[model samples]
Target: MNIAYLPIDERPCNTDYVRRIADSSAEVKLFLPPQEALGYKKLPADKEMIWKWITDVASEVEAIILSIDMLIYGGLLPSRIHYLRNTEATLWIERLRSLRKEHPGLLIYASNLIMRTPKYSSSDEEPDYYEEWGEHIFLRAYLQNKKQREHLKKDEELQLQNLIDTIPKKYIDDYEERRAFNSTINTSMLKLVKEGTLTFLAIPQDDSSEYGYTSIDQAKVMKGIEALRLHQHVQMYPGADEVGATLLARVYTQLKGKRPRIYPIWSSTLGPQLIPMYEDRPYQESLKAHIFAAGCQLAETATEADIILAYNTPGRVMQESWDQSDKDITYTSFRHLLTFVDQIKQFLNQGKQVIVADCAYANGGDKELITLLDEERLLDRLLSYKGWNTNCNSLGTTLCQGVLGLQGNKQKIIENIIYHIIDDYIYQAEVRMKMVEDFLPLHNLTYFNLKDKVALVNKERNKRVRDAYQLLIRHSFETITRLDVQTFAPWNRMFECGLILKCEQSEVSKKC
Candidate 1:
């Protein structure tokens, strides 16, 4: 299968992950736009230019994974120059339709943008015009438009509701308008799916608030996709690593039939903290209990283990730290990870099985750091790693695609993906329990007297625990099963052959 991936330019995480996945499949051919053309300051002038480039290159490939966001926006919203860039989705739909006409047999899959609202802050500039205008109009009108309603004060809440009500009926009441906007892009891709020009459409499940829309039901989304008779896989994630890892683990268990011991090695405390944040209480606690129960046996300092799950969870520990001055201190953590890689190499030399499951953040300025690491022998020593490129960081999207490949049926793939998400939720519960256990002892209290404090703590802890659990759960479940195998199948087969040859060489050495 000749697979061509068109990712957003200069997205290191996405590029790295896709590369890892592609590496798994020797038959896969990756087609990424030049990195110099992918950032906010240096994006391509015309969307047509990028699309034309893809059209010219993709004509030769049998299967193509086209990221609409890349061809249109270049990257994520933060990297985009303006809100107008968001409107480029229309152009993409038009171009994709044209492509369908030209290459009807090519398997085309497109990823849609699901907006997610960032945490609100007074100081932060509102990125969306709809959000800013909605807030402004609502506040101004709510205070003056007394004839329509009364008893509502001019606070943020009243203003918000008033704004929601006054949002031009064309924008708010018109579900068709909203659906049309979505379908403008999705419909074109769906056409390809219907005509068997595209194999599937992968849509990332984003928070409703991001699009200034109400929350959508997972079932509803899946049902809509099924009506089209196209395979749909929901990208399930809590955040990044914790969720990513757990999801990969679950998939691996289902596919491989054996649960590999998951050794989570972190360079800092932030990596450890991620576990309780995202996953559900039962699964989180169970995993912790299992790891601790296995004790030293499961936790090997040496890299000779079957799998080396390494993550610098607090990718920017200093950025996350309370003190900005300490940012330099965080660099040590990454260096330490590199040191660990050296140790793993020694173990490989000793003929031990090893797989490095990497989840780390590379900042905007850290491109050279990553390049240097990749150039060093450290990168090749691992059996596999994620988030090394822009594509890989999109664990949710990659996993969803992989699920489609494994199940082959759209509905069943959606069901299994849902089941996997629920499983992560269960694990999240376990993590919450463990947090309670750890915090309770520190407070010298039990659950009996913990009413008021528990309420406050739970409120804050819930978000944290949810995030951590999701990061590990998602990454683990997705990587082990979907991304890794799809990306590395041929490489692994070749590696196994090389391993046999090495063993024979060792036997000869012994005899000599």
Candidate 2:
């Protein structure tokens, strides 16, 4: 299959991840735009150049998976900060229409984010005024929506009115006007899906909450989807950054005309019902939505499954990845790690392909889960292992890798396993916080801005990752003579990093 993927941004998770998984299969030929053309943070990509590139390859590729934010608004951050008028934005819809007209047979899978309203005051990814009034803006909308939906106490009413009166009207006006514009654009995309300009559409909610601007907008979009009766053609879920890979998986499955059955096994008895952070729905509900979105089915029995998704979720309580060192007692008392690993071993013994979704903590992998897998020498044996950013991000990418791994070469699949361990586990869960705590202070650096000291920070990062690899993985996998892992701070921040892995490999007939 020939696929052209336009990522959400130049992030490694979006670009390199899809490429590595696609490379696992010789049958899949994937094409991506030049990284320089994709632009930097808050900078719009060269849309004309990207459009030309896509048109040039449209005739040859079987499918084109696109990030509508990138194609129209330049990138995800640009989408949030863009000054494009509604009329100007609508022109991009026409561009999509033209693309469809030019290539009627091309399958178009696209994703657009419903702009997020962070609960905290941080202008790092939002507007400058957000540094002062971001929380106020989120609360204004949240309180107003809550008041309308349910009764509010007198104190709550006073707080809402106080926020309305205290915040600068201009700031609120600007933020809301842009949201209205983005919402219109979302409706326009749905219209495209209905008209057959797009084959599949995913509207992923980023940093979504139970109630607020995001959920309210979701209700509006849900009404739009129902009005158009496009449920079968559209999927709305809690995810960002991972939607591209999810759609790519869908395209791969549709091209092969196979809906692989997946059987899910959870770490805790109550894990499936508990909602992870930054999302509104329960973990298992989101899992079902993702499975259906990926062109895969939920297996009723392990005997009939093609993939065993060993999902590692939270116990009675959930916390950030960095807090795993002092994790809640419920993690041990409520969830049994021994039973989880034992089930994974049983599945492997039964000759089933297994994929691990290490979602016990948000923003990194679960150390306890990774340690158990590593001790059992099952790290490189799984089809995929992902725990990064948000719960949905990990779930979506893991599913994509699992689907592609079915036809992947053993070497490529093993390489992906090592890649995730280094990035998701070694870097995100452990080293990132260590640098912020230990290394950053030595250079007078903050987590948000590494400044000119990025190289110094990354130098320390690479060393720590290499050491962790030696400690956690090298002993079990002796086939890897030397593993040189380099980490890059793409946004010059500690929240995420890009990894370049170099491995010296020897031939092995069996799984490590």
User: Which window of 10 residues has the lowest lDDT sum in candidate 2?
Assistant: 503-512
Candidate 1 residue 121 Cα shift, in angstroms, is 4.2
lDDT of each: 0.39, 0.90
Candidate 2 residue-wise lDDT, 1-512, digit = tens: 99999999998889988899899988899999988899988888999999998899899899999999899889999888888897777788898999999999999999988999999999998889999999999998889989888978999999999999999999988888888888988888999999999999999999998888998899989999999999999999999989988998999999999999999999999999999999989999999999999999999999999999999988889999888899999999989989999999889988899999999999999877887887897777789988988999999999999999997887788788889888988888888898889889989999999999999988888889988877776334546756678889889999889998876677753223
Q: How would you encode candidate 1's per-residue C-alpha lDDT over 1-512 as one tens digit per residue? A: 45556654433234544443443433344566555555532333345556666788777776566666566555544322233433566566567777877887765655554433332321122233444354443233334334234454457557667656765655333332443444344445555567655545444433222112212322344555677665433232222212222232233333344434444455444444433211222222323432222111244444434444443344334231112224555556434655555555555577544433223332111222223334454433344333321112323333323422232332323223222222122212233345457766675545334434554444444455345434433212221222210111111111000000001112111211
- RMSD of each candidate relative to the true structure: 18.0, 1.5
Q: List the candidate 2 regions with Cα displacement exceeding 4 Å.
A: 509-512
Off by over 4 Å in 1: 16-28, 35-45, 72-75, 78-94, 121-184, 206-214, 217-220, 229-381, 385-512
